[model samples]
Target: MRQRTGRLLGPLLVLLLVGAGPDGSGETVSLDGDRPGERLDVTLTRVVDPAGRADSERLVAVELRLENTGSVPYEDSPAPAAHLLDTAGQRFTGTAAATGAGPSLPDTVTLAPGDSASGFVTFRVPAGAGLAAVQFALDAGLGDDVGHWSLS
Candidate 1:
């Protein structure tokens, strides 16, 4: 009975550790897409309302850190494909207008093994919209891998 219980706890412990964020705040996701061996780690570093309006719309800035954990190079533009989802199921794409509101992510990114990049992606949502999560992807969402960070 002790051995059986140990086996059950072993896998459960690994699962919890693997899913846990380093700082206990953001999430880390692998961006393999069609590549079998590619492993890119994306972490949501911060998210904030930068205090301003864009034609009756409020701006939300999402800060992210991307690290190349695989053995190969990962190159793509993540800013254009980043999105904001509201509680009402409304999806808001990253906006260029909000770029001036914060330090925006580069239009192109090339990450070699062990390389990392950090920047912000901004979105314009309705004035009173309740943001639920932020969705981010490479290749303008054409890739299979997508990372989501919950706001609440």
Candidate 2:
């Protein structure tokens, strides 16, 4: 019985550690998504609102830090690779033009092991849209892994 308990403890400890991530408001928390050999750490730094009514439709932006913790390189493309999901399940795709207004990910970033890249993904949102989450892909849907962050 003692040997069996010891064996279980190893896996249990790993689970406990893996479950931990950046703390969030009571409504949500940041998450780290990994699939075997590939790992991504996604953190939602902040959400920026539009400056005025005229810009409201194309100004909202979500700032994030994307880290490649895997041993492989993460290829980045010029095309939009992320989307904002609102409370009502509406999807706001990333805007290419909006990226010029702020610090953005490179057109083609190839991350080495333990490397990271930070950037802003802007979206055209309705006046009353409430963003609750973000979905990001390194290969724009061609790859099997995607990183998700919750903002409740």
Best by TM-score: 1
Query: What TM-score would you give candidate 1 relative to the actual structure?
Result: 0.75
Question: Which candidate leads in lDDT?
Answer: 1
lDDT of 1 by residue, 13-96 (tens): 211223333222366666654465566777777677754677988888887888989887887777777788898999988743
Off by over 4 Å in 2: 1-36, 51-58, 99-101, 142-145
Q: What's each prediction's TM-score? A: 0.75, 0.63
Error of model 2, residue 72, in angstroms = 1.4
Pairs clashing in candidate 2? none
Evaluate residue 63 in candidate 1 and report its C-alpha lDDT on the 0 to 100 scale: 79
Model 2 per-residue lDDT tens digits across residues 1-152: 00001112434622111221322212122222233455555555666666224354646666667677766666665237677778899977775444444786555667676887766667777888776666665455333344455555
Worst 10 residues of 1 by lDDT: 1-10
Candidate 1 lDDT score relative to the true structure: 0.68
Model 1 pairs in collision: none
- Judged by whole-model lDDT over C-alpha atoms, candidate 2 comes out at 0.54
